[model samples]
Target: MTPPLALDIDGTLTTPSGRIDPRVFELLPDWDAPVVFATGKAFPYPVALAHFLGRPEFVIAENGGVAYVDGETAVLGDPTAPRAVVEAFRERGGEVGWGDGDTVNRWRETEVALSLDADEALLREVAAAADGDVTVVDTGYAYHVKSPAASKGKALERVADALGIATEAFVAIGDSENDASTFAVAGESYAVANADATAREAADVVLDEAYMDGTETVLAALRERGE
Candidate 1:
């Protein structure tokens, strides 16, 4: 069986601005392996991306809370935390950012990007209210909180299981903190030079280029595997 190719969207398949090269899209469908878009973005984005690339077998969305397969959207994991959780956090002065809910984005979730002025006490309260199940990530700007079950790694595992591909026969490419866990199970993982330091540290190899030139980088790695 062809290996599963799990590609991250933000900084791996496209530029930081979220633009995909048509050339890459052209090459993707012909690839023998199954392709999955593992991303933190909403489900629609990856689904549209797959449509552009002409492949729709699988697409993991909203960090992994939702999975799209064969034109059907399945909630892989429970994204609904009790309303009390959010109310409790808010009561303690933690602000919440409401995201696209069953509309254009079709993602019913709330996000937390703590204000720079937020104190540790407030953050602690938010953490306590979440019961530690929220994803608290420091993106250098602020701490982000999302569903605990949503993650790129978990989504990759879902795709691997669906395709009947062994975890060892997977290639993962990404360039951000969200991509770290997924790389752990990847047979080959790559980080672009433009990637942040955290992403570089997690990847198996760091490329000296960008995703626009990713075809060459991936081809080189494949050749090395044959050697």
Candidate 2:
């Protein structure tokens, strides 16, 4: 059987400037196997992408804080620790820098996503101080303050469980550190050419193409292998 696929958005499916690559509209909707969007982005982002692309809405969002599979929803992460961490950061004069509107985090449910420009050291210290349950992850695009328990690997496990699939049967593709956990759970994992050190190190294969081009390359390979 063709493997179920887990895909990361942002740096994986987007151009360097953060626009969705047009080819996704053509290929993803018709992919033979299941497609799961695994992203550190808020719940809506991946779900919305699946809607627009006409792919399966099976999604692992907020870095595993939330998931949607087979028309059911699961929320697994705690928002308290992340909120406390952010509050402490603000007290320490650290700014999240998404500006007043802060749409990036306004809708987030389980974690705090800060700009890459945020002070990592400060965020870590705050996370450690408030609750050891929360950990800090640098996704290359942003810093995530969340529970380690709520991660892509864990969410994938739940998805697999829900669908009677094996946790080790997925093929994952991504381009940053946020993808590392998913890589660990997958049967085969690919890091796009522009992947950060963590993702490249975790993946079984590092593709030559970058960004959406790399995603297309992997999809093409899957098609050929499926044939």
State the local distance difference test value for candidate 1: 0.66
Report the alpha-carbon TM-score of model 1 versus the true structure: 0.76
Which predicted model would earn the best TM-score?
2
lDDT of each: 0.66, 0.89
| TM-score for each candidate, following the candidate numbering | 0.76, 0.95
Give the poorly placed runs of model 2, Cα more than 4 Å off: none
- Indicate the worst ten consecutive residues by lDDT in candidate 2: 123-132
Best by lDDT: 2
What digit string (tens of lDDT, one per residue) describes model 1 on residues 1-227?
34567787766767556577656665677666778887766666788888877886588765666676655666754544523444566787665433434242234443434443455466656566666666555433344456676667776776777777775687888777877777887787888776678778989998888865763577556645645
Candidate 1: count of backbone clashes, pairs at least 3 residues apart or interchain: 0
Per-residue lDDT tens digits for candidate 2, residues 97-116, read 79889989988899999998
